[model samples]
Target chain A: MAGSDGSNGSKEKSNDFANELPSYNAENMQSNMKVIYYSRTFMSIIGGVIAGILGFTGLMGFVFYFLVMAITSAGIAAKAGFSVHLYFDSWNLIILDGFLGGLMSFVLFWTFAYDIVHIF
Target chain B: MAEDLVLDTAIRDWVLIPLSVVMVLIGVLRHFVSKLMRTSSQLPDPKIVKEGQVIIRARNLRAAANFIPLKSFRARKVYYSNEENGLLFVPKGQAQNAQAQMFSDPNMAMDMMKKNLSMIIPQTLTFAWVNFFFSGFVAAKIPFPLTQRFRSMLQNGIDLSTVDVSYVSSRSWYFLNLFGLRGLFSLILGEENATDDTQRMMQMGGFGFDPSKSLSAEKDGLDILQHEWALPKFEQRAETVLRKLVS
Candidate 1:
């Protein structure tokens, strides 16, 4: 909460330290996001299709979705060689970014394949 | 959960498969059609580009201002938001109406018209096609149980209050495939595909970008931004980290 007026008022700070902090490229960050999005979306679509083929119903289907997503996270982490920061901006990006966005498509395909294989 | 709706397997072969296939095919067709229709956009006005870039530079300065020296940050801030020649300042006539500019440029108008045509035509055609042939039957049932509020949503064309909310009508199935196949499309077409109606809807809302409006907004942001040099704090933190590592 203190300012430059604290104890270091008279100290003339050096400005060359900007190089010390890590800087990220916007384009590279976006590329990482797109990769993660797909990794999640593609995996979830496969999970939904499998769930449908297996005739998972109600809460069981949701649980399967989470389980599938967990596997996806593990796969991504493994693919990244456990250094998530090297490929993604943060741990959250790898674990959670595309999880919810894939849900709608998952439900759609789930119902479609389920109806075809199990129901009408 | 009453499980009494018996759907014919024939309906699966006919309605479910055909509807989903048609939707996917139409999506691919629309993507190709729109890509074919998209004209190469001309370069924006030099003045607008200058204004836009200045704003972006100011934004960058504001975000990274703490990393730079306090004196340099103050100099840059004044250079951007200064009353005399600040980059963010839009002199009276400089803030011209974007609509007037849009009308003045026939090429811009034509490009927007083409975009609108590509977006609207396929949507109207698919909606009409779905409503025409598949308007009365419940096509498929969702695996999840939704509340009664979802009845109207899941059963758009079929008007049977006796039916469960999970049983989707053909028209509603079209909609479900409409939104739900976004991931599949991305898988098939990759990112920035033309088949995305949602992004086009957002684009249709704003016909053209207005540099002056953004300039004024960026001006306010830069004006309020207080620059505090954070390097000193970071230096101390880094020293502590190094000390811990070395010890």
Candidate 2:
């Protein structure tokens, strides 16, 4: 019984150490990489679309906004040693994003949904 | 005879100009009055969504393991930790059931949070958006050179996040997901590639917040203010807790 208790203690310690590691072992890095890749790609696409519409001025605005947002978000990611997406885990992001996204939603509603409203 | 002739011509010319000016003024006044009446009659103020609630259904409530109940109750000032998404409820009670049961059998405890979260999160998000637009967006768009100041003032004026979980099905690690979108996003994205077994285990049941007694509206408002004021101290507490648990 004593020996079993000792083994359990050791196993627990090992488990604790496992949780604190910054990166999943080499095997798991690919999965994490995919998340980061997708987030950055999505952000880039949005930024590019906005830039195309804004012209040179829009390009400048995109660069400026992206730099500020990226720097702030990346700093947070570094401090947490985690990806940016995890910050949204709190559920607060949905509100923040929705409010911010409301800009797009409004534009979409005006352009697409307005016709439907008019027709109806 | 010459003085009378000069005076007559001057008066006649001034009369025509004044007549034109009066006509223009009347036209402008009429337009403004009509516009004002239309504006007043047409636009109703958008309904002020001062209060709203969200119901987030948990996919799995039965999976959580921890269900420890606290004995004593002390309401801690509400503070947000990006690491821990939701407000911590630190009951000043006997901390017995929490430490062991929460650590060893976490799944049951997590289920409780998941169940309550499904209910709490949706409402909180909706109210937050309504508040954000009416409060933040309006303030930011105020046409003035000092708009940024107004935005900051408005931001400081209201507390955006207020979350309370009355009854969770359990009390385990799943509750850790409450931190924020960024935090949850990080967890989901990072969990897939997590190499550290220790971190994975910690995620399982090691990290959790102390539950607190519910506060009244006045108490809750004060708590938000106190949280902003005591933020540094609260963060230190979190860092210490994380260190002790992870190390």
Candidate 3:
């Protein structure tokens, strides 16, 4: 029992989860996530509108949507002053987090604008 | 690609724009209405707070034990885990059952009912309204091509299988906007807006938060923590730095 207990404590010590900082404030991380979420959503809506107005169809429309998303990711990094370690857990977090989640809004608005300007 | 069908532009003014506009307006209205209905979070019982604090105190002691003298560390550890008066001894069968606690608190159940009413009432009303008025006709065309599999989903309420799968019926468009407008709500009402159905669904699926479970987990963590002073290594490094500076 004592040996098992010792091993449990050792396992916790070996789990290198701190990532450069000794501790991360939970409140700050949540607030950062909210900020990124808002910006990403807003940008995707704009992207969809642009794609629709430009009369992009099929796979090309989807590609343009991602292109807009990529720009938004870069904008976030720039907004953070590029010392992303201080604000975010990792680069992938700011880049890829919620990237696909915004697709629903993108498609909804894209189709709306497409039908409005191009079709009718 | 040249075989494009002409749609009446009047439908855009009447059906499409009005549907989108009404949905957004209803969303904004729902957000404020629910905000008005929300009860302020009541404070947890003092006894629970103190018990939780005891666990935190033990954890802090464990983390900083090496900084204190060995005698002091031993004294604190004994005070926490001693066989007689130890704070960590949750007596056998005395462990808290979270479900029972939830039932015992009448206010929790009331709050949950109020939340459900706020979500369900508006949702049902809006869905009924959309279904009544916007059941027939194609609302808009999808900007991308879809397989035949998407026909049932995208072309709901319309029976014309000969029409392309890219065409969305009015009712299907309403469904699409219902889920898709989540981002728009966040943009409009800020984070944790009350109109989010997905957030409510997630809340229902996750188990209730139990304070006692966290308290016991913290106690176990504190119990297993081992202390080894690193001040001696810091002292060695300081000496080496001083020697280098002098040379």
Best by TM-score: 1
Best-performing candidate as measured by DockQ: 3
Better of 1 and 2 by TM-score: 1
Tell me the tens digit of each residue's lDDT in model 1 across B148-223.
Answer: 8998888997778888888899999999998898888887887768766558657744433677777778889988
- Arranged by TM-score with the best first, the candidates are 1, 3, 2
What is the C-alpha lDDT profile of model 1 across A50-108, one tens digit per residue? Answer: 99999999999999999988888887677666866555557887788788998998898
lDDT of 3 by residue, B177-236 (tens): 888898888888776687664576566433244655665566677667776653545577
* Model 1 spans with C-alpha error above 4 angstroms: A1-22, A83-90, B1-3, B195-208, B230-247
The window of 10 residues in a row where model 1 chain A has the poorest summed lDDT is: A1-10
Count of residue pairs whose backbone atoms collide, per candidate: 0, 57, 0
In order of lDDT, best first, we have 1, 3, 2
Better of 1 and 2 by DockQ: 1
Off by over 4 Å in 3: A1-23, B1-3, B40-44, B47-89, B196-209, B223-247
Which 10 consecutive residues of model 1 chain B have the lowest summed lDDT? B200-209
DockQ of prediction 2: 0.02
Candidate 3, pairs of clashing residues = none
Candidates, ranked, DockQ:
3, 1, 2
Candidate 2: tens digits of C-alpha lDDT, residues A1-120:
001111111111222233432222322333333343334433433443343343323135435445534643453355334533332232233223323322232222121221122211
* Model 1 Cα shift for residue B101 (angstroms): 2.7
